[model samples]
Target: MAAEQRKLLEQLMGADQLIGTGAQGRNAQLSITDNKVCRSYLVGTCPHDLFTNTKQDLGPCSKVHSEGLKTEYETASSAEKAKWGFDFDYMRDMQKYIDDCDRRIDTAQRRLEKTPDEIRQTNNLLKQIADLNSTINTGLLEVSVLGETGSVAMAMNEMHKVRTAKHQKETAERDLKNLQDTSGPSGHQKLQVCDVCGAYLSRLDNDRRLADHFFGKMHMGYSDMRKTWKKLSVELKGRAPPVRHHEEEDPYSAGPRSGRNQRYGGSGGGSGGYRRRGRW
Candidate 1:
């Protein structure tokens, strides 16, 4: 976390480019080609942040996230930003990402809705609970009546029946409670999407699993994006002319950029040692 902060600070201040390295003893100019300046960060969130240490963990963004570049992009004249194309590319990428997540969420929600088979199962389970309770009550009533009549053997036999029924009732109640998961007011374990990450989750999930999801990188990354995208989109629309879809090429890369960022994730860089490749 600290390393990320330091890297961000350096990029923001242009310190890495200014202090130890410069062309002809002058500070290097900031441009789209500088991978150190994340184009996505200029307008909104970067994709690399969406997952970390998760099944879908995305490693450190291939491009750097720098407040300095964002500020530069922000303060530039409308024409300047238009020429840079950073804002447009970011929005384009982000919209597609957001749309895809929305689709997934919709699909998950539909899947989570109770089907006829599941509903019938739940109803059957409820009936079992009710029948077990009724048996337990009836046995208890009989035991009480026999005990009052001084029939000790009969009362004892009735008490045993009640105990067995009581045990069955307890198990049935537990299952019922589990089925009535708190994911929704509905009486079933309806899956819910984690608002922070758009991933499907269930209230029936263990506390530890839920904690891991909330604290995990992908979820937090989406949190960061959620906070930024809508505001950024509004700001861009008001401030600059809209970009068309014809230009699919990323203006930042002179040619195709390597998918270096995808190589590093929870596996610690694919055992090929991204660090050994001197990427870090």
Candidate 2:
């Protein structure tokens, strides 16, 4: 197994034009033909060409090099899947879910940090209001005790400060509550993992987004693929694959013309990988 993996790595390194030593030691050379065909392109993070909107000295990607790299990837992926009992597609889907979860958790943590500051600010404002109320009461008592109108103006000023501070305190408290509610583990916007497709879902997602996600092409396609994989696994045990009824058409199944657009819950042309609108 080790020898096989080593051979596969060597073939990949040679086929992918990864021959040069870089800062990270031996690394793949950048392609110099079409940037769209690079390995990073498959992950939707390619920064070459117009994608970065910069005129860097990055070279082009050779068509031949790109094809060879793709072939090597497919070959290695097939072997890896056979060894791991899962395909590259499934791995990519799970990775996307993980990335999404990380992003959400980061956001939630940031929000959670801000909540303490908000609570402190609100408490300070409340204290100010309370002090102002006491001042106003003291001023009013002075006016009544001395039977003079001189302290009435001072009491009115304190009342105004109390009103303003009360308003600010209310606003801050509301914000703090919202942050705590949403940033807490049991928050409405808490992170959720979809069991079917292994995707990260937001608890605060609206009806439309939830519907789109549930009915989205990528989610549905992955679900179908999982079912198919299970069926195939069962059949591989010296039994024929079960036949499906003609009426039981998978709505998420893509045809030849479906293209990559199908992966985004849209109808268009392109190949595999999670082809979502914002992320792959």
Candidate 3:
């Protein structure tokens, strides 16, 4: 494990990396992979910045999202970017993430089909719990009354009923807990998968939480990935001519001038000066 940790990824030389070889400010002069910088952000967008506090939250990024390093990466020439191939590397990594999220979205859709509205299931569970509790209470009362009447066997039998009801109640409680976990943290809402990241969001959530979902990092990160893919997939991979660039060409330029005029001379009645030329 220590040996694995010692391995470093290929890294671009940063301004701060000048302090190499047992230097103070150079990440303890350790392996290149030991840098505190976040490679994902350095190459492009970092997934860590997205889906914060949501179900798909990836937790905080382990490395720093240094703006200076990001700027340097962006300003580098196309040749340099091609040499590094960070764009395509990030693309593959993000392709896996997107593919996984797509699967989750599909699964969530099937789950939604089965569940429809989970709140209704929750209500049913609650009703079952209430019925079970009522049975337990009634059994306990019967047990106590039978004991008072000196019916020892009947009281023991009634106690058995109470025990069975209690066991059923426990099972129902665990089921309810699992349902709530899937439904929402608040425990009363219907769940829907986010189209962007496939994390479950509450259908009954308020504006505040909804806004958070829209603006949150994980959702936004996937959104960024899509936008980047639209461009980089063609640019980095060298596919068809970029339609975006093609669409930006000036639309109103003068077309080619060719042979169109006749060779006839001017009219005799003050109607003409020079004869029309095909090249004019």
Candidate 4:
């Protein structure tokens, strides 16, 4: 790169010349050949002859007074023409270089715009929470019964109450864990103010429930945000989220929530990392 810069600088100097050579001979041709000069009057070098009269058809002509004056004149003319051609080529190259740079800058700016921001991440989390809330609410009703006054109905009602309480606790815990995960040691943690309910819940479970009560439609809109962010960062930046936890341990780590963790109605290690959602 440094050497290329130097070469370009050299071209800028007057030492570099653009010369014209014949297509047939590849040799510099002079307008004032021996035949032409012999026919002309012998005279001391004059500016008019040196600069203009000596050449025809834009030929290389020399003005230098020296023993090799004739040869020098031809060589200098060719060099000058070559330099002009080189300059024209250089200007064209410079324009192309600038155009390429502009394209690169535009591409970079688009990528930056698509990059995830704190507000987007937060909105995404809230949507996930709303989904979870809906699931819990539906599950509660599915397992519950309403009936006229009766012994069996009362027993069923008691069971339904127990089930509902259990469900709420489990969902709340999942929401809490999600909140901690996003807000913990991970520097990328981000959450946005809740637009629907005007109240915020960092936990997934809580956020979902709140969204359900406030802005149900808008909440799920961001369900794909996490996946989207992961995809964009991987494809564009060539980086991934930090692997902060080991797969075998750390009950708090994200994966498929399942097994003993589910039975206990708590967040803990399982076959897969994510805990299975259940009524606590």
Report lDDT per candidate: 0.59, 0.43, 0.58, 0.33
Give per-model TM-scores.
Answer: 0.46, 0.27, 0.42, 0.19
How many Å off is the CA of 159 in candidate 4?
15
Q: What is the C-alpha RMSD of each candidate to the true structure, in Å?
A: 12.5, 16.2, 21.7, 29.4
Best by TM-score: 1
lDDT at residue 112 of model 3 (Cα atoms) = 59
2 or 3, greater by lDDT? 3
What tens-digit string does per-residue lDDT give for candidate 2 at 107-178? 544543435655676577566656655655665565465445566666566556656655665675666566
Kindly report which residue stretches of model 3 are placed more than 4 angstroms away from their true locations once superposed.
1-39, 52-54, 59-71, 115-190, 202-209, 237-280
TM-score of 4: 0.19
Q: Per-residue alpha-carbon lDDT of model 4 for 129-247, expressed as tens digits?
A: 66656765664554454333345656576656656656665666676566545542222232233321122233334756654634443222222222232332233232212222233
Best by lDDT: 1
Candidate 1 accuracy as lDDT:
0.59
State the lDDT of candidate 3 residue by residue for 28-102, as single tens digits: 333212235555676776665555556676755555545556777789897665554455435544555666777
Show pairs that collide, candidate 1. Answer: 50-218, 51-218, 52-218
The deviation in Å at residue 151 for candidate 2 is 11
Clashes of 1: 3
Rate residue 18 of model 3 by lDDT.
35
lDDT by residue (172-209, candidate 1, tens digit) is: 78876776663233533545666445676766789898
